[model samples]
Target: MTYLNTRGSRVSIRMSKESDLTVLVIGSGGREHSLVKICLNSPIVSKVIAAPGNGGIATEAECHPVQVDDPADIVSLAQRVEASLVIVGPEVPLAAGAVDALEAVGILAYGPGKAAAQLEASKAFCKDFFARHGIPTAAYGTFSDVDSALAYLDTQSYPLVIKASGLAAGKGVIIAENREEAASTVQEMLSGAAFGDSGRQVVIEEFLEGEEASIHIMVSGEDYLMLPPSQDHKRIGEGDTGLNTGGMGAYAPASIITPELEQEIRDTVIRTTIDGLMKDKLDYRGTLYIGLMLTDAGPKVLEFNVRFGDPETQVILPLVADDLVDIFLKCARGDALPDKLNLHPAYSMVVVLVASGYPGSYPKGDPISLPDQLMRSATLVHAGTKINPEGELVTNGGRVLGVIGTGPTLKISAEKAYALVDQVIFSTKVFRKDIGWRQLERKPHKA
Candidate 1:
């Protein structure tokens, strides 16, 4: 596909094996590893490179061994290698406007631009956006002062969720179910006792009922492509109890939205969201992630991730049938491609193994013993580990790896997930047992 600029110059991509284009994958985690794995599988890819990749990702691509957040270095590397397409995985770069910077140098990048990124960076902005766009989300009211928030909370029901407006590395949210609990939570935010400056302003939203689900859509301006629905287990313990970590596990396609139901969401929320951004003069390009809650009435948008969600990305990428490069370019050019994108007919589940005491502080540097032939048996995408000078693998961060299992039936996939979980050995390893408990009961129709 060729896209022309305003000056009548043609913008073309190199998608063949003999292509001159190089691939630069930003961010180092299981999510980025999943992307790098997908890109490496592409016959169209010539060279795959990662900036400061982890120990697990180093095996997949040529590791650049530089800081992931250094935008100047990122741009310099792009220019040095003449990268054809740059894919960003984490939210920090997107919030930092790496796409805007890369594009300023004529590099095509996947992910939304900076102006479109405030939807994820600021919860207050997103709540207002939901109200303005009629996006069908949980009831929310924003506040800068704790007194106003506390005053508003007393009039409302128990069990409300308070969120920090800025990035808190997934630990910015607090769910308080009682008067005392809510008061303490407000004090924590207002006094800067938690989440630091991220808590300067808080978004207190009505605690939503019903199950949680994740929906990722590829957007080319107003045109959108929806992936198979997946449900992620956020809480650390079984039966969905315990403090919320990043994500324990995920599985798809969720039985929540059938074809008839999905089409309704596309018409209402998904399409309307992209159209709203454009109407509001926000040029939202690339992927738009809508984390939703399937309630009694219908689906309600829980949060908007301008980029892909971590554990969610681990499972969704395996099911996609279209060439990732092909879809990305199509979206970047703002052209509507085929609506009938294919996915694997089977179900896939990803169980994330985390260190003990996560969503707080956890121990690191634990050795991991993983079996070979992951892609053939279960896909292993590393999140936090580094290779030492002695070539020994050591834990570098929490949320270690996504052990994925794929099969025709959800039961078989779950079985495979647990089976693979048994093979890996790590001290203080923890994962939720029942990842796909809800949707597996209902017979799936269409994602």
Candidate 2:
């Protein structure tokens, strides 16, 4: 098949036969594990492989080691494995041009190229794009130096958001409540004292107030398939009171986004985003995660992520009723997407089990134990785990495991998830007890 590139060039895309499909997923987080699981669930999938897979993924797929951000290494690994379809799971590699490298070698890789990935890789670029396209977003200023950033902060009000322009594994955003804090944060970011090179250029934006929700869209040029809306808890502490981590937990479909609000978001945010990508001649073909703030003015985009979200993916993927292999291939091939996704009429929740003192320095190589049998509604997805030399499963990263629960109702899902959360044991296990507290509180009587 031939698809027209944004540069007015024609590119050939070969669709692999489902009967002989070999999928290669890239990443080492719970999001990648969910992608691997979905691919494996496809009856047409002949084989599945994961690079730098976690302990749970290793049991289901052939795992290999590769530098995720190195484009050449990824291309070589995909070639070695003869992957018919390559699913790039992490934003770092997508931002590093892994998709570009893979496509140069005639590999069907699912992700945006380096230029399009700038939407997620650089906050400055995204803010500029949003302004240029008139997309609804918080007012922001981008600066590359301490003096300039501090100067811009003076003109802003208190309690603003200061973020590292480059990727920081979802931990680069800081909410400054006072002028002193904002100024210090700007200095730290510009001086490389906070997030290294990722903080050299910073985006200081107005702090938005309201509920937040996540929308995951599978894009194929102007067309897209929208997944159920979700909400992620980023703060490490309960009631969202502490420093932000990658994500503590997430649940879907977020009850906050009503049917009416969903349509409003589609009209104002999603459509405008896709049109802007076209206007800029960016051939974006992958997941477009829109972090939204549901304020009095309506839904405003907080951020754009080029790949699936971590804990959100852990909860969302299990509710998808379609063949993920087909959807991924269609997006990779730039085919028009279906009007709507086939989603199960059920709720899903994920409770993340992190090592003690996560989003900070923590211990590794601590042994982990799992229940011999989980309830029918529960699934333990590995995020940071590995089998030590002694063949004992141990914590390998900050966020260790995501306990996913699916049921006909949101309350049941949360109960099931917490039940499994109790069964998982580790020396340094730390998880938020109230993953869906907000929604559950609203619907106190609903099952």
Candidate 3:
């Protein structure tokens, strides 16, 4: 197929036949597990491979070890496996120019190149982009030195948001409550005491107050397809009162995004973003993750991620009823995408199990136990686990596993998820009990 590149020049992409495609998914988390499963289910996919995959993924696909941040290593592996299509699951590889390397070697890859990946790799760049494009977001300032950051904080009100400009695995943001706290955070970030090089430059923005929602869009130039909206619980403690982690839990089709709100977001945020990318001449073709804050003013973008979210991906992918492989291929080839994706009339929820003291120091190598018979309604996606030398499943990372549940109703889905959560046993397991508390509370009680 032939399409117009970002430079307004004709470019051609060869589409592989369904029976001849081998997909290579890159990452080592529940999100990668979910992507591996989706690709395995596709009729066109003859085989699926993963790089440095976790224990659960090893059960489904061929797992190999590769440094995820090295573009040359990724390209070599794709060539070694003869991958028909490469699906990048994490932000690090995208920021490191893995897609650029693959495309240079004539390998089709589904992700934005390094230039376009700045939307997620650098908070300062993203905030500036929003300001330049008139996208609705909080007031912000960017600084590279401690004194300048502290001076910027003085101009803002209390309870501001301080973030490391570079990627820090979703743990680079902090909500500073007072002048002293904000100043200390700025010093720590600039001094490399907080997040290393990723924190040397910081972004200070006004705190946005509202319920948060996550929207995942598959973008093929001007055309796009949005999945069901989801909300992620970022805080470690219950009722969202504690330090932030990568994510604790998530639920899809968040009822908060009513038809009107979705329309407003489409018109005000998504459309504007696509126009901004075009204006900037970024040839983006991949998943566009919009982190939104639904405030009294309207739906405002909080941040952007170049790929699907973690626990959110666990829930959202199950609800998509279309052929995911085909959709990804079209995006990779810059072909026109369908206006809308077919979705199941169902709700999906995921409860993430973390190692003890996660979002901080935690134990590893602790043996894990699973149920004798896995329930059909639930899927156990591995996030941070490995097979120890003793040949046993053990904890290997902070967030260990994602227990996902699906049903016709949100309440039923939550029930099934928690039921399985009870059956899985690990020495240092930690998970949130209220995955869908807000939506469940809004439902009317049965008479």
lDDT tens readout by residue for model 3, 383-439: 999998888999999999999999988899999999999999998999999888888
lDDT per residue as tens, model 1, 247-311: 88888887776777788788778877877897887777677888888788888998899887888
TM-score of each: 0.92, 0.96, 0.95
- Model 2 misplacement above 4 A: 1-16, 443-447
The CA lDDT at 62 in model 1 is 85
Cα misplacement distance, residue 426 of candidate 3 (Å) = 1.9
Off by over 4 Å in 1: 1-20, 374-377, 441-447
Root-mean-square deviation of Cα positions for candidate 2 versus the true structure, in angstroms: 2.0
Q: Tell me the whole-model lDDT of each prediction, alpha carbons only.
A: 0.80, 0.91, 0.91
Q: Write the per-residue lDDT of candidate 2 for residues 167-191, one digit (tens) a residue.
A: 9877788899998999999899999
